[model samples]
Target chain A: MAKYAGYQSSINKAVFIYSPEQLDYKFSDTHPFNQKRLELTIDLLTSINALNPSNIVKPRNTTEEELLLGHDIRYINAVKMAGHGKLTEKQGEPFGIGTEDTPIFPNMHEASAKIVGATLTACDYVMQGLSEHALNLGGGLHHGFKGRASGFCIYNDSTVAIKYMQKKYNARVLYIDTDAHHGDGVQWSFYDEPNVCTVSIHETGRYLFPGTGTITERGSGKGYGTSFNFPIDAFTEDESFLEVYTTALREITDHFKPDVILSQNGADAHYLDPLTHLYGTMNIYKEIPKLAHELAHKYCDGKWVAVGGGGYDIWRVVPRAWSFIWMEMTDQALPTGNLPKAWLDKWQKESPVTLIPTWTDPENLYDPIPRKTEITEKNQQILEKALLPIRSKNSELI
Target chain B: MLIEEIMKTKIFTLKSDNTIKDALRIMRANKIRHLPIVNDENNLVGLLTERDLKNALPSPLVKKTVENIYEQNLEKLMITNPIVCHPLDFVEETALIFYENRIGCLPVVSGGKLVGIVTTNDLLYTYIEITGATRPSSQIEIRVNDQAGTLHDVTKVFTKHHASILSVLVYPDSQHEEKRILSIRVKVMNPLPIIDDLRKEGFDVLWPNMPGINRL
Candidate 1:
């Protein structure tokens, strides 16, 4: 159990889940799924005096039993063996290990379990009422499957943490993924369970990897009408991104009425992110968490657990975008003007690309997208299609 | 792949003497569209489809209800001597039959006995599997000259990166007659290294391409 520094009667007592070991979830020095963003994000928050030790909590290691809630025992054994160099490449192939995306690293199982434990810790804090909200920058490996690793994710921390909440606290979880890629692993985990609803708003999978989050992928069996997806066009700007995000999130929360909200905050949708093509600015990052914070209080009794995900532009986009999530969680006023001079001075020399100087992005971040109107109109159609079930049900009631 | 491997062996069937009402009840209960009409010796005699049943029934807007329509024998409406496929036939050959006949399903016959059935849905799913969209993977397209050993040259890059190839499809380039587009889906998320190697080797890689964008 994490040591809490007594209780203050503050309305927004948010816990930031962190540990130096969380940085151990590294694939390679040059790999795009870098954890150095976590360090940079924490340093930025520290420099602004927005986060301190009392508000920071160290993550625990996830146990084998808890891991079994989401992963198969055979896959877990394979991961363990691969971490120790006992498993051969052929042996690891079926389990999606030793591949280019998730290469075998020393003690990988421990590292991945620690990230899962971090997300579970955040869930415990929020669900147990130790905090109104919690943020685990190490978690949100949303592409990890039950028996396979994918998209640079080894073990899906979000899915395990949601299952932990379901078993330990009996809480109905509403998972919201804002990653540039589809949150397929977490969505499929509870595809037939009515108690867990997943909503992912991402770039369309027409040309992207892991291409499946269509509007037609509503949940199955008893969980029908519980899954929602909004695949926006490639060049979607911040205004259009947030329009679908806010509308779908608000209506879904109203319909599901979940006991807690677990959000995966992947900051890679920015224009600077190399992997995806969405034109999201820092504005969407600021608004993404604000709505979750408000709705957690409204529908979930202020219970919210957040985790970090795919943000490849670690130097330029990730740190600032993630820091905004923490600031929102703590109910701090959104920062404005130039970034902390000390933080920028420390990171600029190390960053290859020039960092954005202001808390807000510069005007006209890229050449104006040629088909902005058509993209927005298409996204609006997708939003309607995704919400059709709930809309029809509400009309039937009326 | 053979039709026996992909066909659904456990199928619903009806005898020719069974009433149309029996076929309708079985179709509704099983939620199946096609039924093979078999004789006493379990030989496929005819095929009954949901479309035939619907055409035999009275329309929803009709004021006069026809009482004798449900009591009619299925043999009167069934497609006698319908085109049937052999279980030993290649799946590709079976698919061609579907397209050429403009039919939705084909019952698999083995030794003059009804054994299995395959529908257009099954064939479409087989296409999806062959395209490798069911797995977690990334797709890469390369334009190569329509010559031998182009596939060998291109796949060498994936082998270098230790990436497994899930599926490879070859199609003629619409713009260039001598060029062919090789769409390869590999079971890995980050294809940057492979893409880099292909570019370094002077291969034209159209990775996640969009319209109105230059291939640079």
Candidate 2:
């Protein structure tokens, strides 16, 4: 725990940073990375009475100066021009706009900036000691690059927010990403920064987009041992996913000893996620934020900021998965059994697929994977190999 | 790719008159194993390697050290007539040369001047790129009959999806003589739609395959 743990009366447990403006960062009607997820998640939270006016804080638009901390000026300008239908395909191609993955949409710049600003707003509340933690459902654009956008992400909110925390509070920030894809943008942003350690556990890039985040990609130069990646095998089920996630997060937090924890809580590893092959279920979601909250209290004096990332199957998967993050944040008893009747009743018409109807996924979501044992052994080996450096270093200290 | 494209252009050289110690220091500083011994006109004269340096010096097993071995001229230990390749040679050709000669690198020469060097690591990286493993893409393997237009049929599915094809590698299938395995990498997060189209086209999708498990 931090020395500031003694402050009790002034700091709130957590603040929910969001606004409807965040829903405008859409690519198209059928794009996979949807901001409607933000609405569905907020609606579920509100139905359960987890959200209120006191806890809800609207997001602001991050300035060009703030966006530049994690983006190139030219790329930022290109996004701005592309947002207003001014940039051509040829010109926007260099900036990773006007493509099938991230096609240009009107007000793209304003939408992306608002997401960055929401994350920054979350950071300020936490770092200013006004809130112990914050959640920005529109943030966690992890694949957005410094000079280009890829994988449907525009401006990387996590990277920009980490930079903001460093510059504003001069604090050592630890970023934890649970997205199905690599958090390449934020990982590369601080690949050589010793103070800002990043830990990402995602599906192996063997067949995933942004084929990076291998176990060998430790930080380089003076920042060696700061970056940790656990690229688990595809079709990895809930048991194996939680094993690697909890073990790696515990080891990395102990090794880095950061002052704050910024977690990118992408809900795309579920079995229903159309983009990824990980076979995670609602169990992982409940535990993901639960552990993040515990570790923040243990190491950071509860200074944790959570952000949303890739989660397709918006109807059945995202709402229930994302609600756990807020429920965990406010110290609500983790819900199980049937979901609120009104919440599911309101959104079932909007959802294309039949909703799961319960707080948890049904038993035996899929047929048992034939190679579960081998996959578990392989993932366990990956965890050991990824932690070898820190383990050896700690042993040397002893 | 040509040797000129992938080869390291910065040549680290040692003269024939330079001492073995100078060769060793250059190798140690650059973290290189092979040193191109050159002349005043920048022509490749010989090749000196760390193995040769190790062979010349006294072994650690022996208590007495041969201190003066470091002072010996590099020409005595270097291979005076090392095989070289032209800049225009294909990387595959150079790879064959290294394999046939059992060497680790090739000295790329043009117009009687040592222009660059190609190491095993460089060739290996080219192979990785050829497999399209370096890019942010997903690979799908298809078993196709080794007939003309078979590749065209398989490629049309990706094109229909507007999925950028990074690289395609064709290899022989061990099970069937007339069949070939086509490994293709495409830049898309959700390849499910593309895979469905390929199956509908009657192409055998061998990968992203979970045979017994149910899929949505």
Candidate 3:
């Protein structure tokens, strides 16, 4: 039966984290990353009537000590002083505050801390069972390490929320990332821990930036084999991605029995993204969240948190792709064809000159050959080799 | 700008044969105000606005049986031949029709097929929402060359000016296949000073609110 999942009684559960303070944390003028992304996303959703006012959740400013929950105290102090326009002796460079990638914008600590707070709030809603799903579209800074920053990310919000979950609820968490770039900081922060299962699939570090998430770097000490990485070839298409992702995710969820699932829904994996070589389409991107929604219902009782990360082709791709994701999370009726003309015109007027794609699903995009059958065979070997049976075999935190 | 550029493509419509009661129910279910009435072949026949349904009440003679009265005059009341446009119609023409007609919506028809629809409210709302016209600030436009470092430098000026960028447009320039001319619109007070700052920094800035620059 071709199922048309008619509009379900949607529970409003989206969090939009905006602060005038975040206007400070910009890298460069020409870079694709900016506060404009959030503004455009919010506008696009609102213009399409996707952002229901009742469902819109705004952000709160996180305190200094609250930031110290997952980050070092010294790092927190460095961020605070940097926000006051006072660069340390090395230009506040050591703390990754005043760098070209992570420029020390005014109110740096407050802005970055709120990102942590936003993700933590989403986690709280799910853990508290306030909603079936939670989203922090503004809070997927997975590139930030515990001590320093890298890859345009300041503090790792995912790690902060994971620690909050572990400490506050004593919950076992599973973190999954399909960003074209590896979630290095998130992996390393939980590398030696057994309770957290970190799985990242990206272009092998051999070719991309921040070269980590190697096949061999499966956790250490008591957390051996808990971390999984599949650094596939550049331009790895969607079919292979779905195959590997679904298999690995299912095996880990079945084995670890996590209480919650956190996923980084990065759009950089699209073929058009200039930053990465992956050729994932919105079709493939939409499926991941839909499947995750189901898995959350089956396994975690619908406790899922999704965060937006990377996508450079802003006009042509990012807005539509992320809107698809948000629609899936909210279980709203999906709009067909390119964005509404009213929206496209407004988007073009605001951002004229860029080619505004007219179709929701780009009709002329390249389709990846179906390789699920072949990929599933390889994925099983990877899963067995990477996911150690330590969780079920020994209940103690060995 | 073609009608395809400004019309709403995603819309819900009803057939002429569908009962007013059923149509009303569908409209209520979808939270929609207008329903395009189509024939069996899906040709636009008429429209049924919420007001139309509401006005079709029972008279004092039939007040004793409201349900029966509603059943009697269901299909007899729908407004036929509502204003519409073809997908190829110019957006300016549609805007004029909307202004002169003072109607909220116009369905898009091509070869008598319902392609899409546009509402005056949608256009007005889009304008206000995107331009940030409601924010009480002048709009400044900067003509940027299609280059890696150009946009970075230009936006940096806005960042320094302490003016929030309301919206930006990367006008698709056919001249430079390698680079695209990006025209950014930022909302701020006194754009001349920032434009001068940009000029000093060797950037091509267009201050629309200035004497020579037209608002278009």
Best by lDDT: 1
For each candidate, give its TM-score against the true structure.
0.93, 0.89, 0.59
> Tens digits of per-residue lDDT for model 2 on A257-283?
999999998999999888888999999
True contacts kept of each: 0.50, 0.48, 0.00
Instruction: Estimate, for each residue in A1-398, the C-alpha lDDT of model 3 and write its tens digit.
Output: 00123464333344444444445446567655665666666677888888755565565666665666668888877877888877653656566655445666667777778778778878877788666677877777888877787667888889888988898899898998988878887888899999998989876553355556667778899998678887765555677778778877787777778889998977788877766656677767777888888788899878898887777777767787777777888778766766677777777876734645554446557544344344445544555555555444655645
iRMS, candidate 2, in Å: value is 2.3
- Lowest lDDT block of 10, candidate 3 chain B: B207-216
Best by TM-score: 1
Tens-place lDDT digits, model 1, residues A97-168: 888788899999999999999998898888878788999988889999999888988889999998999999
Report the error of model 2 at residue B15, Å.
4.7
- CAPRI-wise, candidate 3 is incorrect
Error of 1 at A9 (Å): 0.8
**What is the descending lDDT order?**
1, 2, 3
